[model samples]
Target: MRLSGGNGDERSAGAAQGRTEAPAAAIAVTDLVKAYGPVRAVDGISFSVPRGAIVGLLGGNGAGKTTTIAMIMGLTLPTTGTARVLGSDMARERHRALHRINFQSPYVEMPLRLTIRQNLTVFGQLYGVRPLRERIDELAASLDLTALLDRPSGKLSAGQKTRVALAKALINAPDVLLLDEPTASLDPDTADWVRTRLEVYRRERGAAILLASHNMPEVERLCDDVIMMRAGRIVDRGAPADLISRYGRDNMEDVFLDVARGRGQGAVT
Candidate 1:
């Protein structure tokens, strides 16, 4: 059974409370829709990420995950509906949200010629992060980029690039962080390290994070909630453990399997 309709069931508490009173959520997307001529890439999707929560956006290829991310980041215009980051309308008032929001994606590579320090410094300046030099040093040390600070970004290995990308993402210490395939190509140890660092960041900073990933175990480990999308619509959403119990599955991977394969009817509560 395909999951249809907007996010009445899947919306966070702040979203459920109504936009007028939209409670200081980290991100809020309401009745959001996107289309490409004959294809509806994202169809009436709505969801939110509350303060300090890590929410996963999970789906297979062409499930509209990319488009959705693009919308929130203000890279693409939505066909209709609003997406607010830190209460600023993304489509029209992006400047207000831009400073407090950052995205990290391996697919979106940085300037190869720039050194690790150079790349991060550029982004930090763009966000107007105060005491920029101090912030870069702080991130370099925290993300283990101290040794690579002088190395050209393009000269680094894939895993090294991933780590640098993460450092760039956190340069501004954004209140809202969007990550796509964060651990996609990392080995087991590095991926685990990245996950642990993310957990620590959220706990200490109370930041809201939207993680778009295919790694099921990673999702189960870090996310406080999971929003499953299929064919551009949210099909199932709840805490990872709740979804597992509801679907009678042993883990998030199995629950994801059931939703992706369209196993049952009326998936939303």
Candidate 2:
């Protein structure tokens, strides 16, 4: 089925404006920093994700990925610098843009006693989605959650919860999506299905996606560009194939390894 919205006319208008009137990046970070006491979780990093693009954020544990995502989502205040989403400063004006963005992560949980349908209803209402029941039904069917809609959210299996999280994220047909390990806990086939749905969403909405994942193959498959983070800093970034060639590696996995171990051109420091 077609997604909730489309940006075709916006794209046409942008094209008509020519090179001098390029659209603003859907997500932009400039010298962004977040610190806790003496610890810097993210340090002076900058990047942009254009509309209709999927950009992967890759890093190991304690590498600042979660903190960075939090700051971008306006859940955490940055120590310095800026994060802008759709032309609004996330720190000071996130409310203006929050309705147009959504985030998903397997780690977030819904109330144990709430049914999946109930949870979706609450979120849909919060987002002011018109015809809420129809939107919920659409997402349930698309995410294969129709059979489990009345199940208590906490009782669902890990894979089921992941799908529910995705449905929640898409309830408002967000223009910007932030995903953390989007396919986690699912079987290979299910994971592939989820990726395909994400691709469709991006294409249908001209959305910008910022994905954080340790799955090298998934990153290689879904991302237009990959940003590598290590110790609160970006050590490398490029298209998967370009990074592979630059590091003389056969695939993204090896390239990731090289960076993580400080072995190649864009080695960790």
Candidate 3:
């Protein structure tokens, strides 16, 4: 079921040698800004993710969550400010910095014609994975993709597709994982499974993950810290439970709703 094509692994492995961990901060941002004409997409944002931690980026639509992620990934150049990944400045050393990081989002897609295994092979090669077959097999088993290995990516159900997408992201054994709605459209059981796997991956690799999600429970479960945003600005940042206790709310959802509506104060601390 493997798609025969490309020599990405050599490049990936070479890149890995050059890849360094982000020091104490897996990701660092300071006074970040991005603009689309008059609209300020990200307004003076700053945050840091520690190694081996799961941090959640939470906000309603247009709150600058995606914009911030894009800047971190070096996909969209910032209008101003600094971003660093794996301790390298994202703006100045993106090529060198990008190799250590990988991302997954439901909105992104693998080639529709490619089988699950084929897609994994392609990405594994891209990551310069040594022993690519073993890497793919490991990921497939961890992601529960063994049964769907031969299925065309385009033909799979939402849950199955998510699993495949996750496999693609982890194929390289990246140091920093960026996930945007990793469990979107998944049933509860599937979502829970994905969360457990992510937890294990973080612990095993000491990799940092920055997750952007709308599922409050998902964020609460998977993230050790939560950053809440509104109108492209971070309104609050704290542990999920801390925020809940601070606001006297039952859970993370209530805190999210209050921030989105601007009915509550920003930053509990």
Candidate 4:
């Protein structure tokens, strides 16, 4: 099954020129703030993912990465500011953009009693995916979910459920993909395989991906750019290699620690 919609490839091929002309955004956040009482989970954070880009949302626990993603999904209302998906304001009208955006997280569960195929069918229909059954079959094969398709979602092993969740997320061929711990719980080999598949999918569709994960190597490999959050605010932003050098670290994990530990404070770009 084809993932790339027509014209997306052309735009990606001329990405620089496209930016000069009229840059397309897959996700855009401007001074977005989400406060729970006096505590700000996401405080005045701003960033944008250009179409066809893969950006990492890097942070430690309680660093506000998840909260920001929730705001983008319109699952949590922000205290102030705006988040737009494909030019649609998710705050004001999430419905207009929900069909073209999808989220996958290991922590999120589908209906426990539903079979993998059943869950995919429901989401495909919700997204108004055409030839839905065929789409499901294609995704099952691509994600190696064929054998587990008929099994109840809750009965599957963590690794198996992860694949099913990925399949469900891609059922609609979303233009923007938000992934949280996408390869969590998989064995090393399986985790690598999953990363390769995500890489291919992003390239083929020229889609934008917002990856939230603790795997430093994974972030280094998959992200074109990274945003590091600390204490509910953006502390650093740059390409992974640039950040590594800027922080005088050998890898992203060390850099992540530096920012999370206050060493990288006021390093925002």
Candidate 5:
């Protein structure tokens, strides 16, 4: 089932809520649309990540979450509308704008032959990070990757690799961070550590984060706001608590279940 309306306007309004003195939202999608063959991959979806806020993108598979993130990252073009990264039109100035953003996805592979430290150094240089060694040390320490730095990225355990992936994403000191299933392979303890590091980074740097994950607990624990999508369209969105309250549930998982099952009011069934 598909939602009737899109989230374009809702996202624009949210983006405009950022403080007047701050850089426009770190990320903004306005009336964004993308289609493939007969399916609308992203059906006029929209949202904004205010500086320093952690926003969760929650949905079942094939719901356009990945496609949306790809568009925001300039990895794919939108069929209609626009997306801006750090206040610049992505379509017009993708390279200049993308430099201010970095992404980490568990599904993406880092170079297998490169040692963890070597991989990070390569990416750091590619992003033009100055004092690359010092920055690598800092990220390694924070993500608990100092011990694994010398191990080949492909040889590390799932949790260790996840940490390295996060460190790579932070190498650029980006204003916007896109995380897709960041903690998917992590155990509870390691996942908690990763979450703590991310929280600290956002608090200290005021970076805007867009996280796409199915982990309801992670979303509730980290995100200040949540956008719920289904069948390639946004059906409901709000603060996690607000979504739970609105849906008459005690937790976000329940709310997610309700929406996913097509039970929410005005939602397509």
Candidate 6:
């Protein structure tokens, strides 16, 4: 019982109302596809993130989550289809929207020789943040990096570096945030603290967030909607509770297992 398409009339009607009557989606992807030689990294898939909403992108390795996110960020070009952020086509006009968006990934590292302050300052300057010193100070205080500001980025522990990466991402106060494995290396207590801070940041700023993560509990706690991908296509999507109930599962972990292992196909809707 795979999901079907939506109504055309409703979509047309919504389009007719225009931007003023209905705000534009913060992130919009339509039939997005990406390929490498004979392999299709991301098959045709479409979805959107409304303003202030947090959407989770879930998939096992080789399921296309990273490629999809890269296309959305304009770091990788799609073989076909389109990704638009803030009404700007990512392939042709990402620069227009780049200043309003930010991304954080623990897999992406900062310069090792630069101090935490230096790294923040460099990113802030790139984003054209006004009063850059004050902004850096504010983030250091908020993320508890004040004491580590002068330390070389390479010298910090994994948890400390994760915090600094988050600070760098928020330096511009971006309206669209893309995060990949934001809490990958932190201990349980530190991970919880980081999750709490993210909630506060989203609530206070009304930012649209697209999160790619492997942590089922974290997704269940933070996401308003979840999109599950397998073999480069979206197989199922729904709210966390709705998906759990639909699959007759006790928790999202079970639901994820069903999706990942191709189990319970008759119940997947």
Could you say which candidate leads in lDDT? Answer: 6
- At residue 196, what lDDT does model 2 achieve? 93
Candidate 2 clashing pairs, residues 3+ apart or interchain: none
* lDDT (0 to 1) per candidate: 0.84, 0.84, 0.81, 0.83, 0.82, 0.84
- Give TM per candidate: 0.92, 0.90, 0.89, 0.91, 0.91, 0.91
Could you give candidate 6's per-residue lDDT for residues 31-106 as a string of tens digits? 8889899898888887777778788999999999999999999999999988899999999999999999999986
For residues 36-59, what per-residue lDDT tens digits would candidate 1 score against the true structure? 898989988887788888989999
> How does residue 226 of candidate 5 score in lDDT?
82
Off by over 4 Å in 6: 1-22, 265-269
Clashing pairs in model 3, backbone N/Cα/C closer than 3 A: 8-125, 9-125, 9-128, 12-127
Q: Which tens-of-lDDT digit does each residue in 132-228 have in candidate 5?
A: 9999999888777888889898898888888888888999998899999989968999999889988998999998899999999999899988888
RMSDs, each prediction? 3.4, 6.3, 9.5, 5.9, 3.8, 3.7
lDDT of 3 by residue, 38-83 (tens): 9998887777777787889999999999999989988888898877
Q: Which ten residues in a row have the lowest lDDT in candidate 5?
A: 1-10
lDDT of 2 by residue, 1-269 (tens): 10010111112223333555656678878788888999989888877777888989998888899898988998889999788899899999999999999999766877879999999999999999999999999999999999999999989987788888889999999999999989877899888988999999999999999999988889989898888888888888778888899999999999988888878897321
Report the backbone clash tally of model 4: 0
Clash count per candidate: 0, 0, 4, 0, 0, 0
Winner of 3 and 4 under TM-score: 4
The reply for model 3, stretches above 4 Å from the true place, is: 1-23
Residue pairs clashing, model 4: none
Candidate 4: Cα lDDT at 233: 82
Model 5 spans with C-alpha error above 4 angstroms: 1-6, 10-23, 266-269
Alpha-carbon runs more than 4 Å astray in model 1? 1-22, 264-266
Tally clashing residue pairs in candidate 3.
Answer: 4
